[model samples]
Target: MSWNIFEKLKTVFMKVTQILVKLFKKTNKSTSLTPVSNVIATPTAHYEGVQTATIIAIPTNIAKAVVNCCLKNRIDLAEAIFRGFGYGNTKIVVTEKEIIAETSSGIVLLDPSKYRLSEL
Candidate 1:
């Protein structure tokens, strides 16, 4: 029993570490030597903020997708999480009318609130 608990903690820690690494990786570009792009396709502020929410602005869309995947696999998404390094602080949660994917990308939409805390 203790061993199982320890393993779970270890997995969670590793996942958190990997997420942090991805979120704050060191860039090797030196401004003096590197070239800047003229087409500013990406907005830096937004990228540092809500990236996941930007990917799928309409929550219903991602919810539908997650629901479809769950139905096809016959898996209880609330109980089964993809233990992946790319995920964030929590786990993916799915319900009949809502979806929470904070663990997957640091994106959260709680009731009337919608935003991401990936920068921390």
Candidate 2:
């Protein structure tokens, strides 16, 4: 029995697709760069004579990575990563929101009061 040319081509294509999928998944998927044990909350600044709430803005990717690491390691790595990035003292944090409300002027509607922090 002889295999046709189409069969050979199909087999090659399937192998190539499998390789590409594995490579892409390994590269795109999150992995812990620095070990979670080394992370710590280093204070950046202290506001004097005023009441303030610290809002740490972290990269979405990094935040997701931290969550993944924590889940795997069962440690609170997210807070450590946030503090390590110098978010110990600041207000008006920034992040990408999935549900966005925009007007004609392209202004993002971010009403913090609408969403209670305690619930989050």
Best by lDDT: 1
lDDT of 1 by residue, 59-106 (tens): 232334344544445544343333221233323344433344432123
Cα-based lDDT for every prediction: 0.34, 0.30
Per-residue CA lDDT of model 2 for 57-115, tens digit only, reads 22222333323333344443223323222222312212222111122222222432333
lDDT of 1: 0.34
Clashing pairs in 1: 88-103
TM-score of each: 0.27, 0.22
Q: What does the lDDT come to for candidate 2?
A: 0.30
Model 1: weakest 10-residue lDDT segment is: 111-120
Which pairs of residues collide in model 2? Answer: none
Among all windows of 10 consecutive residues in model 2, the one with the lowest summed lDDT is 98-107
TM-score of 1: 0.27
